[model samples]
Target: MKYLEWRINGFLEAVNFCRFFDLGYNGNRFTWERCRNTQNWVLERLNRALATRDWQNNFPNAKVFPVESASSDHAGIFLTLGVNVICYAAKPFWFENFWMKEIDIKQAVQTTWEHGKGQPIAEMIKSCVAYLLEWGKNKKQQFKAKLKQAKAQMTRYRNSSNPYHLQSFNSAKEAHLQALEQQNIYWKQRAKQHG
Candidate 1:
């Protein structure tokens, strides 16, 4: 979703999407406040996960936000599937990779040449630009692959019988949910460190 959201912005700058979070585990067992205590911890772990796939680099707006963990010890994760995923667009995000395409990191290097790009630290802009490009490429790749797989799965379901079709539909949904959980495990593990 983050990949999709980033691609969405590629073509349409205004394209934006949001996801809400509970910030806690099973609501019955824990409370949001307890989860709040772990915000720093959770984000610290999440940062590593996001870094693993270079996710944040690609989708600038797509992020994991904390509210009040509420009702559960698990801090809720507000993740917006990036780019086209949130918008659910039929068309793919079309854009060229400028820096890598040219094999020239001049503009990328020159980014810091302009002051105010990173006020606190002039080197910050360099890091941001580098991160953005790295993640952007990966995000684009992920987006295309995900989109293709979804299209294929949908086509298969469309061709099958009613029962199998429904089953396939449900199976696909379950798969997605599982994927989301797996993706979120990075942060989950981070929270566990406190234990």
Candidate 2:
């Protein structure tokens, strides 16, 4: 029980820190690999708590979602950090289906491989790698471009002295976020890849 409380507290602190301070342990091994060996300790602690089913009322804001386990004895976890109750929104799966392409995606992958003619093995591999790289880059750019536009529109509110206009921009941003949330399936498909 004490351990669960500790885990919940750690989870809340980690999210709050990221939302405001951008400093906290991220248990993602890849992230740790890039910098100092900083583990996502906070997340790890929360996962441990769930495994024990030791939860209490000490945490009002912390959310714990059950995970579906295909083989493991314990379910996995879905954590929401830096979420705002005032703005309250459904959590999102960072991965999207749009990323998933049916065998049709093989068109992109195969086209890249098939074009490997006079090129050496290494060169052929590089060409295919470049194709996949550019595909990912294009997807990132598309979303970034849209987010940039929204930020620019919000900036216009700073120039206005009227409180009404300021509130208008705030609402506009909320609406923009909602639009993005509704399109989660679009992202899921974009992210899905059978190829």
Candidate 3:
């Protein structure tokens, strides 16, 4: 209870540091619940909609409310700004640094570039980008499939009672760890690029 209070106080301090005000919501008082229906169950208002004074003034009619969710532990917060907003689609192409580690990436880029010979530089770039996006999509799918397979195999081996399964379990576990490491490297690079 003391730790929870400390955390709540720290959160409030951070909010004050940011100079943001909570847009109080209607409906359920608690936003999150854990171990529901049990004696140890817990409920807390862990989420809030915050806004700067300028933002609040700009959208004075904005309303905030919580929508209870049956599928998730936390309720979803909905905000209405009393204004129409247009949303734009995100850029389709982004070069992932992790792609450089793949053996076929260099060859694939070269092939696409060669295929666009005699074309304008912009045309060649567009072609190469289109090819890379398609290739990356396929690569990502394959990587996810492989990782899923590795996890499934590890789980299967782990549940067996036979001593013979130990070696197989170890191999599967190693493969899973390596896959996770590769995924970690990809995300770390992405974070560095975005940050």
Candidate 4:
């Protein structure tokens, strides 16, 4: 129990110090498994990839998977940090379906389209796209700020032993989880990959 508590505390401190989130896994959860009879075997998740928020944002498609290891008791970690970029002869115009879900998307699109009425079709399309891209940039900045604030709040609660703080921490964690889930879904759709 003491060893477990120490490990937990060490993990929490490392997470806070490095401002990282575990990228989770695609295969087995436990990385370490004692080679013994079922009654005596022990399993623990001892390996993982932890990345900072900026890393998570930059490598949105990054995944941590367990690789089969024959030389050791622990499974090897395979961290894939590849970005998919397709080269095209002619640039294709693509609009996100999620843009319609934003509250200000209609106003922004309408205003941009109206202002470019007299311009050529290509120019007008370009103007509207520029406006929408700016809006998306602003939204991303706002989200990052909120995420930072939540992380700080959670860190404070984690260090406190107070029951009230613990309850608040749980709520904060739940909110963070929900936000991450939504983000994962959006990225999965964009990347055309399964979670």
The candidate that achieves the highest lDDT relative to the unseen native structure: 3
Worst 10 residues of 2 by lDDT: 28-37
Whole-model Cα lDDT per candidate? Answer: 0.44, 0.50, 0.77, 0.71
lDDT by residue (tens digit), candidate 3, 1-195: 699999989988998988999899875567887864356778899878999999999999998876544246676788999898787977668787767657798899999999999999999999999999999888777766766787677557754656678777778766666565556667787788779
Model 3 lDDT, residue 1, Cα: 60
TM-score of each: 0.27, 0.26, 0.51, 0.45
Ranking by lDDT: 3, 4, 2, 1
Candidate 2 local Cα displacement, residue 21, angstroms: 14
lDDT of 4 by residue, 44-104 (tens): 8988788898988998889997654424667678898877778777744456554554578
Weakest ten-residue segment in model 4 by summed lDDT? 177-186
lDDT of 2 by residue, 66-92 (tens): 332223323345455444657467643
Greater-TM-score candidate between 1 and 3: 3
Flag regions of model 3 displaced more than 4 Å.
1-87, 159-164
| lDDT value, residue 107 of candidate 2 | 79
Distance from true position, residue 155, model 1, in Å?
1.0
